[model samples]
Target: MVMQTINKIISANEKINDVLMNQSGLLDVVVYENASYDLNLLQAGQSLKVKVSLLGQNACCTLRTVYLSGTDADNKIEFEVIHAVEQTNSKQEIKGVAAGFGKADFYGVIRMPHGSQKCEGSQSHKALLLSDNACIKCTPELEIYADDVKCAHGSSIGTLDETYLFYLMSRGIDETTARQMLIKAFLLSDMPQAFETEIDKWMEANE
Candidate 1:
């Protein structure tokens, strides 16, 4: 198993692959602070599984860490698998958060070739908006050239529910903390179950 988390301001392209089988390949990814990545490529095979999580914190104007306010921040992730060559397929889960006046974009593409049969591929992207001025763009794409493959993709961007906040506040939870906790939970929805420890550490830091 392999685990990796990106927690800095990234400005270049990157390529990553997770191959899970008897070897059990795994990955837990987190994009924190002012972290930024452009033209990122991710590949996973039928025998590989990976969980990706992204959190945007302190989109404020601080001297040490400049706010993430770039107009040309491009992030693209492509996950493909050839299932016929292998079986008992893999899984890919992606999640993200965008707050304040910051901008976020995610593009996901999952492909299953013609000969690949009985392969399962699922991809999802979700974002939270803290301010009305915040901007987020999501594109969930799937290319299936095989008839016997199961694949799906979904994307959503929304704000915290007022009713949920009210319920938490009634239980003695502060409003601000309630909102943060909800956002944190939403961003962590897609993370794999096996990486709970890493997820705990990330929540501690991001929250």
Candidate 2:
């Protein structure tokens, strides 16, 4: 397994994108005040473990993943984060779209280890199913071992919202355009602007 350690001081309102693929490794990140992380995963297999330590107050972290697989592909992601100090914040939003007969799984854990007071953490995982034979699993776990901390997690698996699709189509948008818009919103809404063009090309090629 490979291990990487990153330590940085992010100025206010700065955003960074960390993208990884096809490896088994451990990542350690320290986030500072008002800074954010856009963590993206593509075509990942084997094992990927990430641990973020929020060191400064009001530091924010966001995680988003997209997995496109074929019939024999097996992809998995494991993520963990800790609010190391007081008043830090983190959010994990993982969006996965699965097609063919492949399997995709995401496991996330957030912890506020002792003395990390007033920290807030939240995680949500949503999967889009495009084939009857495809399988997608999302497991979000939280361990709060501190006082005055708030944390929550959620998981859901479903196709696109047909009601919203119909609503957009009724407003003169074609079906294809409406679908693409919905997908882009779901997967790219919180991504950093620097990565938008690359993600757009990826989405078009995969589509």
Candidate 3:
């Protein structure tokens, strides 16, 4: 496959395999020197699976995914990124919120094969629960076969921070607005500006 520069946004409503996979079930992304492929995905009340492969030296990918669950909704998402050559790099950031009896689960993996030396990969999954009945879980895995690689993975499931809320409330903001602001701050880094309206609606409806 010839190297092509690509930066695209993936829609949550479409099936992952239909949109991203080839006949062999892999999105064989061939990136090369000075090239990159970037994808941003948002999922609400749906399940999605994605596998991306970086095929050459100096290839790079950056993926940002968000999972939002509504009332009584169950959602799961899995992501895998494979670095097949030396000097490749990738970073994945995942964020989520579950409210009103909603449940969310995420699994992510970054793999670097034996000869893929000097490759760098990092991923983090973080989720928050808004209701007492809400549930959230995250599992992150890093498989590195090369000794000269830098790879890290982290996962966390938690609720909103009260101290940040308190700080906002002290400035005369109401409890509800303060809480929402704090939650928005947590997600601002990874979310795209294009989804602002949709995310605001989700927050309003979940509240």
Q: Which candidate is the best by TM-score?
A: 3
Q: Where does the lowest 10-residue lDDT sum fall in candidate 2?
A: 190-199
- Distance from true position, residue 178, model 2, in Å? 5.7
Whole-model Cα lDDT of every candidate shown, in order: 0.43, 0.73, 0.73
Better of 1 and 3 by TM-score: 3
Off by over 4 Å in 3: 1-33
Task: For candidate 1, write residues 1-207 as lDDT tens digits.
Answer: 253332333222332322221212333343333332221222211122323332232111100000111123222233332232212233445554444445655455555556545556665565565567767676666767777767776767778889999998999999878876676566444443333344344334433
lDDT of 3 by residue, 100-120 (tens): 999888888999998989999
Better of 1 and 2 by TM-score: 2
Candidate 1 vs 3: which has more lDDT = 3
Which sections of candidate 1 miss by over 4 Å? 1-88, 189-207
The most accurate candidate by lDDT is 3
Question: In terms of TM-score, which candidate is stronger, 2 or 3?
Answer: 3
Give candidate 2's TM-score.
Answer: 0.73
Model 2 agreement with the true structure over 102-163: per-residue lDDT tens digits: 67878899989888899899998877775688788887888888979889898888987999
